[model samples]
Target: MFFTRKAFPVQFNEHLPLNTLIENIVFTVFDTETTGFQVASTDRLIEVAAVTVKGCQVQSSDTFRLYVNPERQISQEITELTTITNEQVAGAPFALEAIEQFFDFVQRNETSCLVGHYVAFDVLVLKNELKRSKFHLKKLQHIDTLDLIGFLAPSFDMRDLEKYAQAFGTRIYPRHQALGDALTTAYLFVELLGHLKDRGYSTWGDLLQVTNSPARHLSF
Candidate 1:
């Protein structure tokens, strides 16, 4: 299926710290289970979800979830995993365009920051995509729950997604869909927040240095 590219405006935001943002800023619990791991050539985002949070509370009304037409064919394995076939997204809006629109929406409508599991991957893919589309990442403070999970539970040996679902006691619904995974990620993050608070740290800065993924420093 052929897709027509739509032009979108780029936004540059001030450096709003996530710790400070968490108190007053809303939280967009964001996640993307993409078509593939790589963000460059052969890989593109197939689905994306953002759950809105105010004062750390999830608000269903202020959420965004979409299945994007990647403007290309999803592989057999990916299609089976996500249950999103080429035909399903053939006429849908492009993924990049959807993200651009989502960015504008979030920047304008919500007073939130972003939270994601293995968030560096999301950030990396987003920055790379923006660069490809000639956009800037004014760079808001983003919280990475993968790092949080590890920092919070250092002894926990987690190698798979099921492990997280088991450890956090959060249900992983809908398997490969973006919103389902994001919702689970949000639940896991909330659990992590409780862990941090129990440890006498209520601010993000107190945990930022210790909660970053080891690979995140390599690129993010």
Candidate 2:
């Protein structure tokens, strides 16, 4: 039987000390593939994937990927972009159950923060899904790689992930696949942190100072 959101009693996240070393913090860099961008109402998650970054390293062995059965016909356009077939998710776990497994993965890794490119949208997608079950997510600590890129290059206009990865000389991965994008973002995230460190942002507090401005960080 599927459990309600509250039935999962794992502490998958924590508010770390401000002075915590950046190397000591575990970051869950994640991505979601959805039916579309209208997450607040119609769009639903088709896939969710994350990779763990610890001590300035991407732990390739530590990864999580889940295919969520949206229970609705996926549009042909979305299927083309994400290459996710109705058949693939037909027998997959529903949103709540898949998310529970995701939380379990996060709990096992003891993640301190979540990272994504334009992460607010993905968070919203998750929020709306939980709201369907009358559940809600607590305020989460999240960082956007897009914001980091903006910080590094304020005049850069292209907001595309692949573009940023290319410009930054980071590893490029298969587009639209959830896990592949997560891995790409993981490498990009570590590369961005290296740049931040060069600019004297090495501690959790230092990182927060730069990223905590209004419209900089997303709280769920």
Candidate 3:
């Protein structure tokens, strides 16, 4: 499928009030499945999904999921790992169109922040897709659940998403598939926020300190 290039509305993450309570922020917890991890050159995005969270709750009715046609063959190893066969994405929209829709969903959800398991990688995946179409990701206000976990439990070292979910006792969904992982991550994100609140980090600024801290960086 071909998509004509068009401008997408800015996410405006910097405009949100830092004084707002963390619970009051609307977070769009999202995940992506890609052709591979080398997003800058060869790997392309295959699927993206997101769930909304407000007041530390997953808003079930507000969700987004899309499979993207990568215009390339799906490697057998990836299909085995993700269960996303080439046939599944044959009729799907291409990366640019699918991403535009994803951005539209974010706008419609009134998201104040974006959350993900390993958010920097996912952000890079999206940026590469946009760059392919001569578009730029101007700014993204995002939080990594991975970083939050580091800040909250510096002694805990497991970096796998399901392991962290199991350790935190959050809901576990089917692994690898975009929406299922997104749902799992969303629940885990909320749980992490609860722990942060217990430590008196209850405001947007406070949460930012934890996520933005250089010490919170995890190798995973």
For 1-220, candidate 2 gives per-residue lDDT tens digits of 8745542244645677888889999999999999888878888889999999999999988999999999888999989998999999999999988888887888789898889998877888777887777676766677888778778778987878899889899998889999999999999999999999998888998887777656433333
In the range 1-220, model 1's lDDT, one tens digit per residue, is 8543334454434345756634455667777756788876668777778877666556667778877777677898998888888887788777668787678656765534577777777777676665566554543656777677778787876745556877878667666677877777776777677677788777656756656545443131
Query: Which prediction has the highest TM-score against the true structure?
Result: 2
In angstroms, give how far residue 174 of model 1 lies from its true place: 1.6
Which residue pairs clash in candidate 2? none
- Which lDDT value does model 2 have at 217? 37
Q: Among all windows of ten consecutive residues in candidate 1, which has the lowest summed lDDT? A: 5-14
In candidate 3, what are the lDDT values of residues 20-133, reduced to their tens digit?
Answer: 898778888899998898989999999999999988899877889999999998899999989999999999999989988987888887787788987778888887888788
For model 1, the local distance difference test gives: 0.68
Clashes of each: 2, 0, 0
Ranking by lDDT: 3, 2, 1
The lDDT for every candidate, in the order shown, is 0.68, 0.84, 0.85
Clashes of 1: 2
